[model samples]
Target: MISGRRQKKLGVRTLDIAKRLLDYGFHPPTIYFPLNVEECMMIEPTETESKETLDEFIEAMIQIAKEAEENPEIVQEAPHTTVVKRLDETKAARKPVLRYRKREAQKQ
Candidate 1:
């Protein structure tokens, strides 16, 4: 269980870190809330993951931590390699878009 804490007034968002994990070919753990903990990352490794995979995940986390320390911006703005970037959670929650709507050109 990794709990991220804000340091020196620099905001460290657990959500951002989780999103960054996607860039590393790993799924982020469930974070924050429920436990009333701040920036909590609950890591539960399944038997399916091989030793190599676990090693890679550890490496990615170490790299992310380093980035957070040196260049916090990188960690702050994550998922740079994904097909879609960040989302507007507030807007999405307020106005949910469940289904996809194809463009007129695509309908042709």
Candidate 2:
């Protein structure tokens, strides 16, 4: 297990990533993501030095960040995962839909 300043340095990376993602239109990759309390963006690169796994995951994460910066289409298309994805969530968020299409018009 990585201890001391290294771990602390790594720990702050979550925030760093979030702040960096701000440049893009989307929010910081969902701050404390997943809603599982501590089960968030706590990637322990120090814990794993398997080279391939580390390189691959880190590289992908980097590419995701870059993609977020350059073309957000990739980030938005993060598919084949769970229920929260693969749909136009914005459409579901329309309050008119929530209120059964009761638009504020013609009502006296």
> Model 1 scores what on Cα lDDT?
0.83
Summarize candidate 2's per-residue lDDT along 58-86 as a digit string, tens digits: 56567655655566554545542333444
Best candidate according to TM-score: 1
* Clash pairs (backbone) in predicted model 1: none
lDDT of 1 by residue, 71-97 (tens): 888878888889999888899899988
Clashes of 2: 0
TM-score per model over all chains: 0.83, 0.37
- Which residues of candidate 2, in runs, are more than 4 Å off? 1-40, 45-49, 80-108
Backbone clash count, each prediction separately = 0, 0
Model 1, TM vs. native: 0.83
